[model samples]
Target: MTTVTTPDAIVTAARGWIGTPYLHQASHRGIGADCLGLLRGIWRELYGAEPEPVPPYSRDWSEPSGDERLWAAAARHLLPGGAEAPGQVLLFRMRSGGVAKHLGVQGAVGRKPTFIHAYSGHGVVESPLSAPWRRRIVARFTFPEV
Candidate 1:
């Protein structure tokens, strides 16, 4: 049976990964996971197997080539252009004129919004969606219906 993916469920699943170590291209819950890996783990919990295989990626994430590879992958797998809400996937551009690479799952909305992500040094954490972070958001998306 296919599970109905809900915002609350997504948030809960992401929250479960809190404190997981940040490992490049790894997706094992509580052990290691990158930002994309966090989303992949949540996708597995909500839907089953991943829709596609993820090739090895570098820390730059195709930035040197000026390609939005991560954004393109997200567009392929997720429903784009969703209203800001808990559980939405947030794509961020870490700097001006750079490829959007960082990702986070929206945790709390409205006043004092937060997002859960696996940062380089901090591991998995739910941080306030402060203005600096908000300014870097390049796109928002929701998981596809199962």
Candidate 2:
């Protein structure tokens, strides 16, 4: 059976992961999860299994190679180019000319937008989509319809 998921449901599921410790390449809820791991966990919760197996990655995430691997993977699996909405996946370029690496789930929109993400040293938390963060956003996407 195809499971229908809502944006609110996605946001809720992401919120449920709050406080998960940051662990490189890990995706277990409440135990450890990196930004991508958080998204991977949410995908597993929404769908039965991941669409593809994730290969081991370093914290730098292909930065030295300047490959847009994360963005490419998202575009391959997610519905790309969606309006800013709760549950939208956000891809961020942490530095100028850097390969987009960071990921987050839109938690709120409008005047005071927020996003849920697993930040190193902070775990999973809802953070304001502040100016600096907003400026770093390179792409927006929504989960595929299952």
Q: lDDT of each structure?
A: 0.94, 0.93
Model 1: per-residue lDDT, tens digit, 88-142? 9999999999999999999999998999999999999999999999999999999
Provide the TM-score for each candidate, comma-separated: 0.97, 0.96
Q: Give candidate 1's error at residue 42 in angstroms.
A: 0.7
Give candidate 2's TM-score: 0.96
Model 2: per-residue lDDT, tens digit, 32-116?
9999999999999999788899999998999999999999999999998558899999999999988999999999999999999
Return the clash pairs for model 2, or none. Answer: none
Clashing pairs in 1: none
- Candidate 1 regions exceeding 4 Å error are none
